[model samples]
Target: MRADRLVSLVLLLRRHGRMTADRLARELEVSTSTVLRDIEALSTAGVPVYAERGRHGGYALLPGFRTELTGLNHDETLALLSAGPGRGERAFGLGPALASALRKVVDALPDAHLATASDASRRLLVEPETDLLSRWPVTEDVPATTMAEVRSAVLTGRRLRLLYAATGETARWRTVDPVGVVTVRDRAYLLALRSGADRTYRMSRVLAAESLPDPAERPDEVDLDRLWRDRCARFLADGHLTVLVRVDPTRRDDLLNTAVAVRTEQPGPDGWPRLELTYQDAWHAEWALWQLGPHAEALSPPSLRTALHTRATTLANRYG
Candidate 1:
């Protein structure tokens, strides 16, 4: 609490240049005696803080005093401010005291930047229901500080201690060599190689992590893009096999625009546009048929056509 008060006093003085003792006491919600004591403590800690007497004086940082983040450019400054208190606290490993300190830095920005940042904050709202977040299981909140550190290690190719919770297993710690971090939709993942292996783990499933000492023998250079592509291909291969569909002429535009890949479009016997869509599997094809309703139908693959008919029968039975 004392440390927090001291940090707040410093920030206030830095932002306002000077303030009366009474005003400081009021802002900090402490007695004037507490403010005076804090001022002494900050001075003792090498902060160039001083008091002045008379109508114009309270407390001030000595001229030329600057904080650690004084060199950030305008855009960087806005980004820091936009990240808000939650991210700032986590990114810098600061608790409440550090949050108070960052507020001063944000407050000290030029008026124009401050206004712009404020306006942006009001206009930009990040809705929480993104696809990745929706799909991810609720486990525990990942601290911002940990995520930032993990990201740093990933970029630097450093080994890290990861506390991972595998599906159907208790969380256990492991030392991993982090390769990178990836974001799919709203979910965050740490792509890391296990200490002795070539595979990488997702960060979301990771419970906790710590950086490790650099290895003596470096692993072979990894082509991250190639690895990602291969992983995706494998995942798709495991899904349902391909199926084709035909779209009605009235819905041809929607099919052409919405389908993953529309292979062909031509008039069928009834003057409807037959859209050939190569689906990843039967389930997907059936789902598409349901979405299209009577506007499209499965054209080939007798098995899928039969499945669709069966699904329609089931639906009719339920209603009947």
Candidate 2:
């Protein structure tokens, strides 16, 4: 961690030239003492750095001393400079590191293209910090300590004792073999084996966690994407309740996109589209179709129709 901070410090100086210890500390989110120690470390490591004493003096590196890093082609340089203020980096606690890396990308560019590239990048916008019309973004919360412990367990191939709070169930501890951690749509999940069965646990629902001593018996090599796909396929296949439905022609894509699957499609007598679909259960079918409202109608399996009608009546009565 100190090494990483040291590298970031060097990159900062390389990018922005001489900066006060106070400024560096603020940029790196550390104390002035830490920045001083890092500067001493860099000097000890043979970095050509020096201190200046004056009313407007601070730390500076030897002119032209740059960290030899990845050389970006023209397009890559533009892409790096045009990237969003990454909210995803906050999810993994890499926000500062990402910023440092982006700085390095700019610092590493050839001088001939530097000004023009930097100027052109300013023309592009990707989710600016504030806009007059846009709402502020809210990311999901997972306690930092809990996420760090979970991250350590998954990275080290260790088992975890999870105090997970399942829906409507009392908080209970389970020992799970860590397979991987995934952040989907800003929500983090742990894909693991609990009692030799695949399970997915939302990181937010984990009340507490502790790493186990024993190494998890995870495969030496894993393709996490493939494993996730297999898990998803099995989950969908297990959702056995099938229904026949008719949807307005214009909303066919909307229905298909929102619904889990459309197993079959045809045209009905009125020339609207008809579809056969599957769902996890009756509640799943009822709720999913109910959200579509009048655009789609559950045609058959009589039970689904009755369930929808009952729900509509209940809503009407409540509103009345």
Candidate 3:
């Protein structure tokens, strides 16, 4: 733990150029005395760190000094480089920080693996800017001042006063306890509680927000992953169609990935997998099955099979 702290301390100085002992302590979540001891440890371990004394002075790394940290294996190097194109940066308000961090990740790789990794990463696209049928990602205008308040309230366990619009409702001011922020498919949601009931508000829907001075009346800890999953299940259950089908095993992953909700799956006697799924509508079920080509077959709720048949007939006639 101390070794990690020492390394982190060095990196902090490296990234920021210099930091005062108190600032380092706050960042590292340690005592100022502990920070001083870590600096001594780093210096003793042959790191080129030094302190300057003055009202405007702090600790800094020597010129051109850097800790050697090229430990990524070939696959790991490529994996690290496989990042999406700045959608997260826009959603989380990270802006240019993601770009800067990615640059550092690539530059930190060993010399021999660097070229190979960079070359391989180029051939892979996480989310390309455009394709033949490109839908440009629209940037949502989540006001910086409002987001700042929401983030602070969530992080500090404080309540927030929000001028929010619920589906078709007018924007109204109400105090709510902050839970956490969730980003799904580039859209941000603020998960919080109002009147002790869980509520989810889209960031785009929040007209304005302010951090309340009072501490939020909520649990000390929340299982956000579990909570999000439960919410998603409940959401899909509302006005969503359920379809049972049989899919080839090889295409199982593709089906699961593309489906709105994979309710259940089981091995079938015919060597395929039986899948129960939920989708927004009959049209959605039709489109998803179409993507799987002949690998998937709709088995129930005859309307879905009808939709597929109609689509296939349309395609056949078009080609005819």
Candidate 4:
């Protein structure tokens, strides 16, 4: 409990600079006496924390007080930063500003940390098969100022007014209580409550989003991960058209990794792997078969195999 309070005290001072004992007590859900004792403990730890009394007074950290991360050696600090791509304009939509801030943070690191980070950068490289940079449409720029406001509203339990466009549709404005935001496959989505139902809209589809004054009652519980997974499962199940396929053992992993649903793998008489993969949709199966080339053979659901063969024949005709 004391350890938690001490961490809370440091974090509070870091964020708010100065807070009154009453404020700290309310935030930590502890009594004023407990907060005072925690303050004493922090002072003993050489934290340079102090408090002012009476009107216009509160707990404050001495000017220029800095917390040095002594435990994390230089290499460790650098490795941490280098381990993940810096969250950039794509996530924050701040363009050059985010890059500038990231540069500053990385540059300010100690020499050891800097070296470790440099080494890690060289050692580890992640290249997505398809470049998302090209897919992101720069023309649909939601104002950075408004985007920040929406993000804040989501964090602080507020509502937002969203101007959105569905695929092949004109933009329309609607009021939604912000629930959460999800980044899936490098695409940004806003999860919100609309018309008594939970909904998700692509951030790219949102032409504009502004925080609104009207605040809806926050839900008692928001299991966003579960909710999103359920939505995805339902969507996939509804879209899927069951198709049985026989996949060569050599290409089994490839098919398993693809976007197909409910795959069952078994060995054939020749000890080769055979797979029955359900395609969420006919179009997807047709596309997948074409991609699989010779490694996959359609086995069941006569209509699907017929369609695949027809397409393959058509392709052969065109190519030949």
Candidate 5:
């Protein structure tokens, strides 16, 4: 851990040119004393770090002394720098690592392209969690400890014990063979096998996790991309209930959030949006539409219409 902290300290000074002991301590989440000790360690280890004693003085590395990564060309470096900010590395608890890597990449670029690449990267802004419509993308909060356990199990081929809560379900304990983890739109999913059956658990819903010593049962080689696609296809092809509805323009995103998918959309006769939405089941359809109140109307599937009508009537009666 000290080694990592030392490298991070060096990278920090390299990136910012100078940082006070307090600033370094805050950045590294350690005390000022620890920062001083690390700085001494760096100096003892032949690092060219020096201190400037003054009101505005702090620790800084010697000029032009940096760790270089020379493999990337100008375009490649630009692409990485431009795309690094919005990659949602924090979702996987690798935010620090990503930041360190990007700093190294910048340090490695040729002097001719260094300024140009930094400027170019600043021009391209990507926010994966924010869409054009300004709707905040749904995200899950996963604890660092749980993520570390899951990641360890997946990487080490160990069995993972999970306390997971599925959608609309109670939390349950299960031991699984972790295949891999994937991040989509700021949400993380852990693909694993439970009792020889495929299981995909959202990282946010994982209440607790542990990496067991027992080895996992899995293939010698895995194609996670193909597995994810196949599972998604199978899920979509399952017995999902479809509903036709007309929703107010303002509440469209509210409906979209609950619906499994939007099958079709068009302008309604009343100038509202008519959408064919899919749900997991009849109850799911009723609940999702009910959340929108009068802003959404179920147009087809007599059973669903009757269900909604009955519920609305009951509510009216209660308040009448």
Candidate 6:
């Protein structure tokens, strides 16, 4: 796994002080190019690692750098292990590997702290995938091979070709310069540039991905979090159909899951909660409200009200 390899790379550097790219590659059993890419990723992630240019020059961690978690006290270890890997690892197809890594870490803990940390980890409970309402967690199924290709492309800074199935569009081929991958709420997205334009593709929507040999054209440094936020803002700002809804407070979460964004939320005059929601279009707005049945009422955009009323009347007359 890349995570394990990265950790091993750091440990190798820390132990050996300095090592050439070829030496590291042989140790890690990966190509020299792959070792170089890993070093770049580590540097970008704020690890105090730097390269030297002379013949004796190689990759090295800054002096006195330590990647030790053994210093963690019992409580700290418990908290770390208790939280576990969760769905994020599964989303990235690293569940088993992460679980193994955690076990290794626990095993490496001091003998005095080991038993206590293990027992404590078992005692603490993380939230279940299903909630009290029996709503199952959203699990996007991105093929393992597809995810691997995309991940490799991002890690290696290579260009990518994707067979993407975009929302409301037919599946098509696209070429992009991959920047990074981000997982939010169990959904993975590939953040990349398509012809110098920002493009984000949901990992599940990528039917297939090919890592091209050509290097990706991208800035040396990236602010992935900021870029993701900016893209999200632009997406939410475009062609959204605003909806004002009065809904049963208990069903608010259900309503939220279906909407694009929640603009404003307050108590309604009728003793219910009022929410200003946005959807992709009028149809989406109407459908989301309808799903809640009488628990939700659309209060604006005459057209949506009429559409719902017409549907209700049609159903009512047929059932009557």
TM-score of 2: 0.60
* Per-residue lDDT of model 1, residues 33-62, tens digit only: 989888888788788888788878788999
Weakest 10 consecutive residues, lDDT, candidate 5?
66-75
Could you tally the backbone clashes for each prediction? 4, 0, 0, 2, 0, 0
| Candidate 5 error regions (>4 Å) | 1-75, 128-135, 165-172, 233-240, 245-255, 263-275, 283-299, 305-320
Better of 2 and 4 by TM-score: 4
- For all candidates in order, the CA lDDT equals 0.67, 0.82, 0.84, 0.73, 0.88, 0.88
The positional error of residue 153 in candidate 4, measured at the CA in angstroms, is: 2.8
Q: Which segments of model 3 are wrong by more than 4 Å?
A: 1-86, 100-124, 130-145, 247-259, 266-273, 281-297, 302-320
Q: List TM-score per model, in order.
A: 0.46, 0.60, 0.58, 0.63, 0.61, 0.73
Top TM-score hit:
6
Q: Which residue pairs does candidate 6 place in steric collision?
A: none
lDDT of 6 by residue, 193-263 (tens): 99999898998899988999999999879999999999988888888898899999888889999999888
Estimate the Cα RMSD of every predicted model relative to the unseen true structure.
16.0, 14.9, 9.9, 8.3, 16.2, 10.6
Candidate 5, 1-320: lDDT as tens digits = 78778888998999998899999999999999999999999999889999998998999999999664265666778888877777656757777788998888777777878888888888888775667778776667788889989988999999999998888999999999999998876789999998899988889999999999999997769999999988876786699898999999998988988988787899988988999888999999999989999899999899999999999999999999
Could you give candidate 4's per-residue lDDT for residues 16-71 as a string of tens digits? 98899999999999999999988998898888888788898999999888784334
lDDT value, residue 200 of candidate 6: 88
Model 1 misplaced regions, further than 4 Å? 1-108, 124-149, 152-156, 161-163, 168-175, 195-198, 214-230, 238-302, 317-320
Candidate 2 residue runs with Cα over 4 Å from true position: 1-69, 82-84, 90-93, 111-139, 239-280, 299-302, 309-320
Error of 3 at 193 (Å): 0.9
What is the C-alpha lDDT profile of model 3 across 107-206, one tens digit per residue? Answer: 7876778888888888887756654446465546687778878988999999999998888788899999989998886678898999999888899889
Give the Cα error of residue 118 in candidate 6, in Å: 2.5
Candidate 5 has a TM-score of 0.61
Clash pairs, candidate 1, are 190-203, 192-200, 240-281, 249-273
